[model samples]
Target: MPGFVHLHVHTQYSLLDGAIRLDPLIQKAVGFGMDAVAITDHGTMFGTIEFSEKCQKAGLRPIIGMEAYVAPRTLADRTAQDNKELRHLILLAETDEGYRNLCKLASIAQLQGFYYKPRIDKAVLQAHHEGLIAFSACLHGEIPRLILSGNLKAAEDAARWYLALFGEERFYLEVQHNGIPEQTTVNEALFDIADRLSIPLVATNDCHYLEARDVKAHDVLLCIQTGKTIHDSERMKFRTDQLYFKSPEEMTAFFGHRPHTIENTAKIAARCQVDLGFKGYHFPRYNPPGEERSAEEIFEEQVRSGFEDKWRIILQKNPDAERSRYLERLDYEIRVIQEMGFSGYFLIVSDFIRYAKTNGIPVGPGRGSAAGSLVAYCLSITDLDPLVHGLLFERFLNPARKSMPDIDVDFCINGRESVYKYVVDRYGGGEYVSQIITFGKLMTRAVIRDVGRALGIPLKEVDAIAKMVPEVLNISLENALKQEPRLAEMAQSKPEIGELIDICKVLEGLPRHASTHAAGVVIS
Candidate 1:
């Protein structure tokens, strides 16, 4: 049997569409005796870092990739009458440059090309195609779609275009056997195109789940994603049970007649090598107007200047204010920040917060552990004085913690965009400054209601069942069943109820969707 690698795979990071969790994915890959696995989460790279770390720890190669959405036209074209044609494409990072290019593509798709999905046009692809390997993806890929539409000529043209763009060695014609009849048809035409163009044929399962037994739960996940009942005949469905991660032996057997299909996957896996080398801080550079001094120098100067103003306020509030004590605390905090190489971080936060205040944008004094920092108070990043409030600066930024300082500032709803705009303008363009992406997981209560709905349970009954899960942070269905015996009784008494809870257990904590984090922003 030829060795096969899963070059097209999805994890829970693919949101509601995929059911494979990362930890189990690693375990299964090791158990299957595979040396490498790929994570091609749909239109996103949210799981790349975590996947890479876990795979490395498990002694397997992690091929960081994305199943990208390609727009038929320009990213900016969103006219109502326009086709807004979208197709799937698989992209793998073969080098650090490839990883960087993948990041650019993901960001551009989200920031500029987002329509029904985050998308990129061929123009952007032509520019960012370097250091990346291209696969025609599953049946939803451009070439396959064209072939299915009886445009074999067009499909061949698309194949040639990708061949030229990614070069002979970097491009491959992807074939999959997901038990979908179209896949068989698509593979036949894909083989012809590969032969005519001298491109290689690679096989993938287009795995959405970990095992065959996971098909039902994964199907319910799709139902939850589409907000449809499983009984609905017209509901979107995978139409096959074969979209599960298969072992090398199983894949080799499936493509026995075309052994090279199995061999090419291993070849691709061997060629893919991406190291993110995540270490150290790349803080945004902050320079005070007309000051050539280092961030540390400027940071101290600004803190002291601002402290003088704060001192006057303190003296007014309490005539017996301990100036020496306050100064000592401020010195300690500044020293810690400077020594930790976070002076630029402090300056950057201070600059934006100051901008919000000067521009009459209502800003919260400060919140969270950041309110405990004397440096923040003196810098005007916070209004509450740590000494007066008896707050420990160690809670915010400690010398021993060796972590980035997190300062949470609340801006008025109407003016939040202005603050973000100011930060981007001051630090760099949109490429350097972007909001952080966050995932919303399927928690206990939500999952119960979602699974119940997809199972065609009445709304009132679903609501009652979901409420029994208890209102707690990060509770699980099993815990809910244990905590509330009445819920467990219902699950035991009714076959449907037991099924709903069983499915919910499989999906709980899986990411349901992705959205921008309200306050989290990355500047580098």
Candidate 2:
């Protein structure tokens, strides 16, 4: 039997546009007997780590890819029209090199190429084309748009350019069937170009949801994204409901005439193998000039020196406290930290905290389980002494459990930026460090308001309806409606309210926006 794979999948990380959640999506793929699946979310790799982990757990090979928005001109050009005319390009990481390049491209897109969307131009693609497999995306892809515009020569020229950039073996002609009339035209042209150019044709569904029945829910999500109602004819929508993840049998039935296209998906899936370094921390190395001490040695020296300072202060408050117990606890923590290869992480964090305090930045007293570590107290990472407070070292970090130690540090709001700047300057520069990305999801109250506004409901009515939802964490609209009978009664009585509630139910829990993480910074 010829196995089939879905090479183009969009999870909820596609923001408001994609309706499929990661867990259910991977489970469905496994249920369908799929050995491999790909996640090509829009413009960001935010879900890559989660998707990869879930897929691996489900016994499915995870393909890390992104459906990138390509700028019409240079990424530096942010003219309104230039931003508006961005196209689609799909890049899949095939190896470790490809994964690194994918990360670089994604980071650069967010940091530098962000206009209306995080976009990359051809130059950026050419620069980071190594170890990546390129796919001419859907209707919005450059070649297909040119083909639809009747510029067959230009389309061929564009295809040739990509073929040259990503070698012929690595670049593929992607064809999708969503029952759109233009798709037929594009597929025909793509076949002709592929035959002439010696490029393989890979069949994909452009899946945005798990099953066929999810089309309505996915459509409602699109309406939420565009701020339009289902009644609005001019709003963006799929031409047909065939865009969901299809089983191998269904895909073969759809494209049986060209079995090779279906088979190519499996072939491509086999080629892409990414190893995400899971459960591993690559902490930055702290190299103090003219010092030969290892990170562990440096850390021990600092801990001893800092303890002398802390011990003097402790004697003034309680002169009878035993020093031997504190010393034993600190020695145990140092052994555990060194064995775990986290000595450098502790050293790096303490250095920054010291810098902040010496330069007049207000630091918070130790909070979280991290206050339980005696080493942290000695290093001045926290102001509280663990021994005097009888804080357990195992609470902060345990040899029984293997996980990274999370130390929450609070700095004054205004001084936070200065601390970050100092770390960046001390480490290397902006090129070596970048802020982590964070996502905002469409919560229960916000979804109700958004759907109400999009449906042209009055603000007062929306506010009243939203107030019916409880403030419980992770509460769903269904649960809220069950708890508050008025909401169910209103939905049953009024058609508009019923429609708004239905749409909001589908749009709930989807990602609404993205921003930089508050306290996370990565240095490499």
Best by TM-score: 2
Q: List TM-scores for all candidates, in order.
A: 0.87, 0.94
Using lDDT as the measure, the top candidate is 1
User: Candidate 2, clashing residue pairs?
Assistant: none
**Where does candidate 1 stray beyond 4 Å?**
1-3, 56-59, 73-85, 149-151, 288-290, 307-333, 356-374, 383-401, 410-418
- Candidate 1 structure quality by residue, lDDT tens digits, 348-415: 88888889899999999889999999889988999998888899999988788798788888999989
Worst 10 residues of 1 by lDDT: 77-86
**Total clashing pairs in model 1:** 0
lDDT of candidate 2 at residue 381, scale 0 to 100: 92
In candidate 1 the C-alpha lDDT for residue 224 amounts to 92
Instruction: State residue 364's C-alpha deviation in candidate 1, in Å.
Output: 5.1
Q: Which ten residues in a row have the lowest lDDT in candidate 2?
A: 213-222
